[model samples]
Target: MAESIRTGRRKPAGPLAYAALVAASLFAVGPLLWALSTSFKSPDAVLTDTSWIPSAPTLENYTIVLFESQVPRYLFNSVVVAGATVLATLVLATLGAYATARFRFRGRGASLFFILMTSMIPGIAILVPLYFLAVEVGVYDSYLGLIVVYTAWQVPTVLWMLRGFFQTIPTSLEEAGRIDGASDLRVMVQLVLPLAKPGLAAAAVIAFVYVWNDYLIAATMVSSDDKRLVSVGLYNYLSQYGIEWGQLTAAVLVTIVPMVVLFVLMEKRLVAGLSAGATKG
Candidate 1:
C-alpha cells in the first residue's frame, strides 16, 4: 500500500528553485552581457538599441581599442606587475603562514588577528601615504613601484589563506620528512607544497585578480600613460571633451573575458581550496 501511494503521488518539479536560480544568473550576468552587446554595436546603435541583442553590430570599436591604442602596452604592464606580485606574495606569505601555523611564538595570536583585521581596512585611508612612500622610494610611475605596492597589499590575505590551509595539513608528514634528515625548508618544498597546491593555486589566482583589477593605488602611483595598468588605462577612452562609449565598452569586455575564462577553468580547484581552508580556519 505504501509503494502504491508513493508511485501514485509524484513530487513537484520545484519551479520556484529554478526560477530563483535564473534570476540570480541574470543578476550576475546582466552587466557582462550588456558590455558584450555594447562592444559589438555601432556608436549610434548603442544609445538607440534598447534590446540586449545588438541591432547593428560593428567591429570598428574593437579595432580602435585593440589595434590603435596603448591597451596592449597596458596589458603587458598588468601581466608583469601581477605576475611579480603573485610570486612575491606566495614566497613571503607561505613562509610567514607556515611559521604562524607550526611554531609557538609570543604574540602569535595577536599578530594573526591583527593581520586579518588589516585586510578590512579601507584602501583610501592609506592611499596618500602609500603614494608618497612610493615616490620617495623612486619606484613611482614604474612597474617596480606597482609590483611592490601590490605585493604589500595582497600579502595579508594570502597569509591568512595559506595559514588556514597549513593548519589542515597533518604535522606527521613534516615529521616524516624530518626523520628522513630533511631541513624545514626541504620538508615544506618537498612535501607540504605538493599537498597544498590547490590552496596555493587559489591564493595565487586571487592575488593576481586583485592586482589586475586594482585601480586607486595604481592610479595614484602612475600618471604616465606608459606606466598605466589596464584598470586605469580604460580611462584613456575619456578625454576632456567626452567619453568613447563604444570603445570603452569594448575595452570593458576585453578586460573581463580573460579573468572570467580563468575562473571558469579553475573554479573546481578554487572552490575546493577555499572550502577546505574555511573549515580549518
Candidate 2:
C-alpha cells in the first residue's frame, strides 16, 4: 500500500527530462548567443576564439549598421508594414472569428476550410500571379502592397486562434449583455472582445512577428530601395567577396530586438490564450 501510494503520488521529473529540456533550450538559443557574441566581437575575435564572450566587446558594428547603411530606413519600413499588418489582421480576424464562433450562418465551415487551405498553397507557386496583380493594381514596390499581402496571408491563422478564444467566452455573458439592452455589435465591443483581450494580444503579436520577419514577400513585393523592409535590406550587408559577419550579426540582432521585447511583454497573454479553451470547457 505504501509503495503504491508513493508511486501514485510521484511526479515525473527525471534526469532525462531535465537533460532534454536543457538540450532543447540550448538548441533554440545557441544561434542567438552566437550572433550576439559575434556582433560585439571584432572580425579578428570571430576568427580567433569564436567564444560567447568577446575579448574586446564593442558597439562599432551597431553604430555602422544603424547609421551608415540604410538600415534605419528599412527598420522604419518594416515597423510600418508590421504595424499595419497587425491592425488590419486584428480587425478582420476578430470579426471573422466572432462570426464563426457565434453565428449559425450558411457555408461557415466551408469558408473556414477555404481559409485554412490557402495556407497549404506554396507561396512561391503563386508569386508570379500575385506580382502581376500588384503591378496591375499599381501597388507594386510599395508598403501598401506588403501590408495587404501580410494581412491576407495571416488572417486565417489569426481567425482560428481567436475563434477558439471567442468560443470559450460564455454565451451567457453576451446574453446578459443583450438582456441589459445591448446590441450584437455593442456586446462584441463591450463584452466579448474585452473578455478575449489576451487572445487578441496573442494574435497581434503573432501577426507582427510574421510580417516583421518575412523576407520573401518583402523582397519580391517591394523592390524600391526606399521601401525595402529590414529583412530584405539586410542582404545589402552581404557581398560576393566576403560577408560582413560582424555587421550582419549586429543588424540581425537589432531587427530582432523589437519583436523579442514585444514577445516578452505578451508572454502572459500567450499563456492565457493557450489555457483559455480548457478553462472555459
Candidate 3:
C-alpha cells in the first residue's frame, strides 16, 4: 500500500477505453486531415485523387491564395476586427465583472440576470434591427460597425466568465490593497488584474475567436470588398463557374493558422483559467 501510494499510480486504461479515445480523436480530426491533403493536390488531382496521400503534391493552390487573391487583405481585416473586439470586450468586461464580484448595489442581481438573458437571444433574431440601426447611424459597410456589433455580442458572456473568475480571487487581497492606501482603480490595475492574467487570457482568446469566425454579422454589416472579413471573403472561392476546392482548402488552412498559434501559446493559461472559473461558479 505504501509503495503504491508512493508511486502515485492509478489503474491503467482498458483497451476499450483506448480504442474509444482513438475513435473520438480520429472523428474530430478526419476532416481537417482531408482538407490538408486536398490543399496540396493540384486542381486536376483534387477531383481525381481520392487518396489521403496525393500522388504528386503541388504549391499552385497556395500561390493562388497567397499572391493572386484578396485573402491576404481579408486576413488583415479579420485581425484588426478581432483584435479590437477582444480589447474592448476585455476592458468593459473586466470593470463590469469586478463591480459585480466585489460590490453590492441596487438591482445587482437583476442587472446580471438581464445581461445573461441578452446572450441567450439568437443573433439572427436581431439581424434586421441591427442592420437598420447601423445604416441609420451611418456606420454600415465600415470596420467600426463590425467591431461594435462583435464587442456588444461578446461582452455579456465575457463579463460572466470574468465575473466568475473574479469571485474565485480572495477578498483579502483587495482589503490589503485598501490598507496600503490604494484606490479601487489602483487595486484592480496593479494587483487584482495581475493575479487574474490567466482569466484575462482565456477571455481574450474566446472573444478573438468569436469575432474571427463570425460570418453573418460580417456579411450583413459590411458590403464593401475592402472591409470584408476572412469568413466572408472565403465565399470568393465559390462562383457560377465552380467551387475551387484546392484553393478553398488552402485558404481555409491559412485562416486557421493564427488561431492555432494563439492556442499553442496560451494553452496552459487558458486551461488554468477555465478550471478555476468553473470550480467557483
Q: Which candidate number would show the highest lDDT if scored against the true structure? A: 3
lDDT for model 2, on a 0 to 1 scale? 0.86
For candidate 2, lDDT tens digit of each residue in 44-133? 776886678998998998998888888789889989989999999999999998999999989998999999999888889988889999
Compare the candidates by TM-score and give the number of the best one: 3
Predicted candidate 3 versus true structure: per-residue lDDT over 1-281, tens digit per residue: 64577456877789999999999999988999999999999989998999999999999999989998888999999999999999999999999999999999998999999999999999999999999999999999999999899999999999999999999989898899999999999999998998888899999988888898899999899998899999999985556227889989999999888888988898877877787784576
List runs of model 2 lying over 4 Å from the truth.
1-17, 278-281
In terms of lDDT, the poorest run of 10 residues in model 1 is: 235-244
Off by over 4 Å in 1: 1-13
Predictions: Cα RMSD each? 5.5, 4.7, 3.1
For candidate 3, give the lDDT of residue 149.
94
Question: What does candidate 1's lDDT look like per residue over 141-237, in tens digits?
Answer: 8888888878888889899889999999899989988998999988988999888898899999999999998889888999898888888888755
